[model samples]
Target: MRTVTRARLLIVCLLSLRYGGHDEPAAQSHGLFCASADAHPTPFILRFRKTDRAVILPAYLDHIFDAAAAIERKNARRYLYTNNNDSWEETPFNHPSTFDTLALDPGMGERIKADLDAFSKGESFYHRNGRAWKRGYLLYGPPGTGKSSLIAAIANYMQFDIYDLELTKVSNNADLKSLLMQTTRKSVIVIEDIDCSVKLSNRDGADEASEKATDSNTSCKLTLSGLLNFTDGLWSCCGEERIFIFTTNFKERIDLALLRPGRMDMHILLSYCTFHAFKKLARNYLGIQEHPMYLELDEAMRKTSIQLTPAAIAEILISNQDSPDVAIREVLAAFPKDMPNERAGNVDGGKCQLSHNESKQQTFRQTMFVFFQKTKHLR
Candidate 1:
């Protein structure tokens, strides 16, 4: 009996070894799996392959791998991004057909046209070493001289986004750099009324001393060197394909450091409208090719001290767009009856004078400003 029991126990041990040996090789050591509650008693089990530690909780590892894979898939093609604090609002900018179609001074118009053409062809006059693609325009003159209008015309012509930098909103050079970086390519960066934005440093010391004497509590965050470095320094090279436009009511007020050669690629003197400019405005606003008053208006423009700005002409034309005759009549009505011989000889008057044009330009500038402000507000 004892011999029979020993033989039975040996048979049982042999069967256990055979089953365990076959099971070890069938379990997989390394393979991923997602857990499903439907699977069985254990939340996860080893995928069948020959290894230990193959089983893992799908919640612990599967979700992490899935998230990583998702991120890689989403960011596969994006390369550029721009961010700014200013609200992204669309402002209507329609290029005035009259301004483009009319012939002003052939010489000035041709030069401006050539420059704009070059810009359209992707050629920058200042950049030499394949770095820092920027163009600067210094538009300086008295108020009511079509400075802002020129900006609008340029923007409309180029179809470029305008990044109107409010210097007061910028804290310092770093802030300025960040703002510049946020501007996309094929855009214009404008700093209008720059003279008032910051207290500029002066090399002559006279201007600096004068400013110091006048205001003691003044604190200037932007210095001349700071501005120069921002525009021309190596840092400016970070951006490509952009235009920098600076407009000031008084160029003389700006330090020479700001206006040195290469700093301002172009200095557009938006003076009062000449006889040529007036005729062009007429052709544009009023479609009268050959009016009876054409020669008289021309002679009047040449001889009369009355000087109308393009802005004033635009307002008169806009108000009477329905009737070219009314626009022409209004323009002539605004002119003085007696043309000043000396003033007429000078295309642009030196200072404020009692001329028909002077009064018209003043009124035009104010009215346009209000118009633009309202338009901007609406937007």
Candidate 2:
């Protein structure tokens, strides 16, 4: 009986081994269920019931990680990224401007806000429509017209990062592309005074310059075509939810390519301060929407041919903050007598259109001019 039992056990073992060779091992069927590090260094579990299941696991994990990252970015505080050595670096983004504080035309502000809201919520819509999830804005105005301030206000309103792209620092088209790729989604890529930064000329002029430079062994050349490609090329669609803002005092100097319909989605002309804008400034600075002197100030602004920038008006109001009446009177008195129809000529076309530092000097000149005129009249 013992010999028979041994023979049966041997036969069963052989049968089991033969079947196992044809079928998968139990371990193979169960798969290696364990935690593994993802590309982002986040640990996640890997479980599989079949050999073919692992094929889809990486893609599944990637989707989950992407979703998580998108949520994190949406909630995270905004950053001000600057380019350094062809890479991006983050810095604390502390911009104090908001939509409420910004002195813009009521209708214009509302339109911009509406557009921003649509863009933020229309991810699926953009995909369905086969349109790039991006928007471009061209802000053209004189110095102190609040172009930079408007940018800050938009950034604050959208809770988006600001990538102040300094074209002069960039080496070439390749460097520009690299810098743009490094930028994350939901950020503003600003090229302030684009015309001044590079020689934004017609296609013929750019080609001629490129040809000359190719012959001469010069350093990196930034051509108009390269810039347009950077803004609206196929690579520009690599990232999503981005805003391209270009500011220039001389809109006429900007290349026609940039002004084309689809290139700059919106052409915003931030002209001189209107009475409506002044009312906003008054409410912001003096905390009074309707003061006794508002009518007089409105009349004064209407009668004056000079177009005062929001910055110039803001300085006058803040200077005499202690007394609302004094501030209003001072602002009214400061209106330039020579309301030249062409103040654009005063701006240095070769330099930055309207820098913050230059705004102060311009405001000082405006104030001093008004002060001198007033003093002379008193005498």
In terms of lDDT, the best-performing candidate is 2
- Model 1 regions lying over 4 Å from their true place: 1-104, 120-131, 202-220, 344-379
Give the per-residue lDDT digits (tens) of candidate 2, residues 1-379: 1222221111111111112343445533545333334433444344454334446446655766777776676678888887774888888888788878888876888998998889889899989999889889999877778899889988877778999997766766788889988988888999998876655334444454542233233454666767888889988999999999999876877778888865798888786687799889989998887888777777766655455678877877776667788878777775544463333444432122445555566556766755654466378
Q: Which parts of model 2 are misplaced by more than 4 Å?
A: 1-75, 200-218, 336-379
Residue 169, candidate 1: Cα error in Å is 1.4
Q: Model 1: which ten-residue window has the lowest total lDDT? A: 7-16
lDDT of each: 0.58, 0.72
Per-residue lDDT, model 1, residue 238, is: 78
TM-score, every prediction: 0.60, 0.69
Query: Candidate 2: global Cα-lDDT?
Result: 0.72
